[model samples]
Target: MDDLEKAETVLQALKTAEQQPPQAALPILNGLAGLVQGDPDAPLEVQEVRADVFMAICELGKALHRGQPAEALWAPALTAAKRWRGLLG
Candidate 1:
């Protein structure tokens, strides 16, 4: 799948993973990070999105790793995902 599709997939996975153990989410977070870091040929707008999403994922991952409740992870990541979706329209 394309990168955008991959991101959406990762986001969906993250959403589905709520209330589960943090360890279960780490690999998915890694996948999201790889998408952000893997693209060097993206245009400026896409790169900006990648950066924002990357930051969101990083924060979410850290919180999860620290044993924070899953509810703490949703809002910021959802906001970032929404912004990324807006970029396509």
Candidate 2:
């Protein structure tokens, strides 16, 4: 899949993980960890998008830690991440 698609997939996985307990989500989170680190073969723009995605994921994590319910945080996080992805596009 293309980088934006890949990034979206990763974000979706993150959202799913957010809905579950942290221990249950660890595998999905770990699976997605590398894509945002930017592979050497990927375009710079894709790398930048991945970085934005990573940041958004971090924000979501922080929100979760701060006791924000998944229901409340998911939409805003997804919206922000999509906006960042569009900018990268």
Candidate 3:
């Protein structure tokens, strides 16, 4: 998915994680993580996106590790992701 779509998916996943299974959200995170890890020769801007994605994953992991609410995690992550997406546009 594109940046906007990925940001939207992550935000939505955060919002309804209680109602939707982890099955739904985990894959989106996993996919974004995979993309972030992939493609070394990407443009500088895209590399920045990878950095944002990595940070987002770190936030999510940190929240899960701390047993804290995801509000703190996804808010910034979504902002970064959406900003990255906007740059792409």
Candidate 4:
């Protein structure tokens, strides 16, 4: 598939993975990182959104893995996902 198509596929995977319990977020975040890294042809907004999503995912994963409350990470993830949706639109 083309880069854009691949990126969209990754993003959809992220979205689906985010809906699951915190235990499932890390692998999906790693997948997103692989999809976006070094892909300079992607739109600036898309790249930014993906980066935000990646960081948010990392934070959530860290929090969950460290035994912190999921709610502490949930807001940022939701915000990042909303921003990603806006960028996609």
The numbered model that scores best in lDDT is 1
Please state every model's RMSD to the true fold in angstroms: 2.3, 4.0, 4.0, 3.2
Q: After superposition, how far is residue 1 of candidate 3 from its true place, in Å?
A: 6.9
lDDT of 2 by residue, 1-89 (tens): 65566667776786688678865665665666565565667666555666766766676666556656545655655665566457545
C-alpha lDDT (0 to 100) for residue 31 of candidate 4: 62
| Winner of 2 and 3 under lDDT | 2
Return the clash pairs for model 4, or none: none
Angstrom error at residue 89, model 4 = 2.6
For 1-89, candidate 4 gives per-residue lDDT tens digits of 55555556655776676687767765665666665453567688777877876787777667767767766666676576666656655
Per-model TM-score versus the true fold: 0.72, 0.54, 0.58, 0.60
How far in Å is the alpha carbon of 49 misplaced in model 3?
A: 3.1
Which residue pairs collide in model 2, if any? none
**Model 4 — TM-score against the truth?**
0.60
Count clashes in each candidate, considering only residues at least 3 apart in sequence or on different chains.
0, 0, 0, 0
- Poorest lDDT segment (10 consecutive residues) of candidate 1: 80-89
lDDT of each: 0.70, 0.64, 0.60, 0.66
Model 2 TM-score, 2 decimals:
0.54
How far residue 11's Cα lies from its native spot in candidate 1, in Å, is 2.1
Answer with 2 or 3, whichever has the higher TM-score.
3
Top candidate on TM-score is: 1
